[model samples]
Target chain A: MTRVHDMGGRYGDGPVRPEPQGVPAFAADWHPRALALTVAAGGLGKWNIDMARHAREALAPRDYNRFAYYEKWIAALADMLVSEGLVSRAELTDGQGAAPGPEGPAAGPVTVQKVRQMIANGAPADRAASAPARFVPGDRVRTRRPAANLFVDGGHTRLPQYAAGAEGRVLRVHGSHVLPDRSAHKLGEGAEPLYAVAFAASALWARPEHPRDEVVLDLWQSYLEAV
Target chain B: MPHDHSDHDHPHALLPPDPALRVKALETILTRKGLIEPAALDEIIDTYQNRIGPQNGAQVVARAWTDPAFRADLLRDATAVVADMGFYGRQGEHIVAVENTPEQHNMVVCTLCSCYPWPLLGIPPGWYKSDAYRARAVREPRRVLSEFGVELPEDTAVRVWDSTAEVRYLVVPMRPAGTEAMDAAALARLVTRDSMIGTGLVTAP
Candidate 1:
């Protein structure tokens, strides 16, 4: 299903307001804390990044549209904490803990030093290529259309609705990486060969504003089929 | 009206608690549960707010413009080159440097989520994460560029990179003219965050 967050080529939102250079990273005091808490809690490792993304995407469309950027992060983080048995909804709502925490190998005290090290050494997503890449640069391909039964609510996808089923040319091949479709659902990593596909703006939109322009998307191989 | 003993200064209290209060409550709960550390939170905040940002990207851009070999390395394998320069981290696990030339222009966007090169450019600007940019950039990039005060020639092809996967993109904007005598640091000062995002161009100062 095309979730509300999959907003590409849709219109009438508003004009872009470029903030002045050197604007503070957080607009308000809570913004940074929200971001930091989300990152820190994520280190608990109960859920992966894709699962966290799914939690956010699962927000009701109205709520997703209403919440500010960090608000979504905070909301999703709270949901994950409760659902993962790390915290309780009562704890979140009442501003106090009501039960004992889960027993496990203590995941963290993710210290400041540890965070700094984590930042320097990022969580690399590239996994060993399960098989040879099915396509290469200069190959013609088309993104697969979502099957009617496929991608219902909670089915996460990296393929935006705008480029679905659209024909494009492969610009480059990025080796296997974790596919969100499977990872978000608690399925295996299901790494796949990713590609940079270039589609003509005219092809993506029926009414061409700039026919000479192009829209390039980095898509996993599963999302595409040989044209 | 019945005299109630709840803390209701005004009718606005009928609404949900302020996000600040909500967040503070979450922090308190998480800390109590030992799921997170406040000090680590402080570190994450400080690192993004102060240490990493567009200056890193500007320095990379400056180096690329002044050093052809470095520029070639950047365009060829941005991940290794930038890591060699010590700018590798989360949100920037894999990097691709798409150069903006006279013939073509490149812009980056993530419609699904706000995926940016945080190690290089820090947090994305508010405008980049806005609904309008995510919706309109790929469909009408020329118009979006114009809104950002960039008036590209009609002949120049605009390439909009929708970051749908793990790979993050950085636009290596063309070096401005009349700066041949300036050093890399001086040129770095002229590179704006938007230029590296493909919304604005570097102007010779």
Candidate 2:
């Protein structure tokens, strides 16, 4: 049997204690500018897939430092969401009337789940219905020409410092979607379904490579072209 | 010293949601967004369908426990060998292996996002995606672990890994007592999904 210990008290050695007030207090007008930037850039969900992919790849267990960057970025996004009137202060304070747990008012609202629910229940359809795929399944296609200057989203871009302008067969087709590589407008690759094209190892790298080894890449539809 | 076993059952009691349903819910949400790129989703479905899960990790761990040579290979280069089993791609190309001993414990968390070794461990458990766990695990690992029935002594430094790009980590849990004579298959059965993720340690039946 594992003996459960009360280790909560040990975590308070630093200035990490939860505020005594049931809710975090700040001047109502003290809005986070980073979030306002996201709103100005566009809705938070506009950056969803890129963010998820970043979180999944760059924020693994060993990369604590990078994960901290994501956390800060996400927090900034959240603050922007609230200030933009996309999410109300009351919604964050009281979860549209759900039972409050011991955590506090912000616990329910500030979570990604909460923001997602808000998106589900309310985010406007700026571009939800557009058709973005340039190719169909089974099409022989290749990656479009790489942009001369690399454009990153919020932070440092993780798109291979190499590996752009690669070509592959369109094993399957996805709809039009936002290109991870920021376009001329500087907005995220907007509302589009990305594609997963499988490239043969021999094609991606020249020298000697096993023909059987293949690399499958998830690319926005806009990134592909007819082979 | 004789120990009371009450805590063990309670922690294990918080079973996770059905994987298919959870995936379904997520898929439904993405699909509605018109974001479900069928081709990409198919690859995700295929990768998850064919490989990636606890069963795959258990096989590797069990093989390592029994074979010194395989253990060396796993420790030397997990990503390549795991990819050799056809499980490597963008997220799992880099790998680091951590061993779990009776005295010293280890657990994995992204704290930022769900950076999991999906090629090896299959899909991550639902709790790994929970905001409560994600926020609290790095800040209060021992406490969060105790809630999961993993009690490490204060002296044992529980390294909470924050998985990121360029590196990945997996836990090689210590074999339970009285399991030395057990076959690899039997030992494999003892390897729980949580143990592989470093959320909970495994015990023999």
Output the number of the lDDT-best candidate.
1
User: What i-RMS does every model get?
Assistant: 8.5, 20.9
TM-score of each: 0.93, 0.44
Question: For model 2, how does the per-residue alpha-carbon lDDT over B1-205 read when each residue is reduced to its tens digit?
Answer: 2221221222111112332232233323223333222234334333444544577778788988999988889887776676676655434545667787655566676543465765567555546644455555544566677777777655565555544233556799888888889989989888877788777777878
Q: List model 2 lDDT by residue over A106-195, tens digit each.
A: 221222333323322322212353664667667777665442223432232322312356677664433343443343223454555555
Q: Candidate 2, residue A98: CA error in Å?
A: 39
- DockQ-derived CAPRI band for the predicted complex in model 1: acceptable
Best by TM-score: 1
Q: Quote the lDDT for A144 in model 1.
A: 86
Which lDDT tens digits does candidate 1 get at residues A125-224?
Answer: 8999997899989999999886111433437788898988899999998889998888876768889899999999887998766778899999888888
Interface RMSD of 1: 8.5
Tell me candidate 2's TM-score on chain B.
0.75
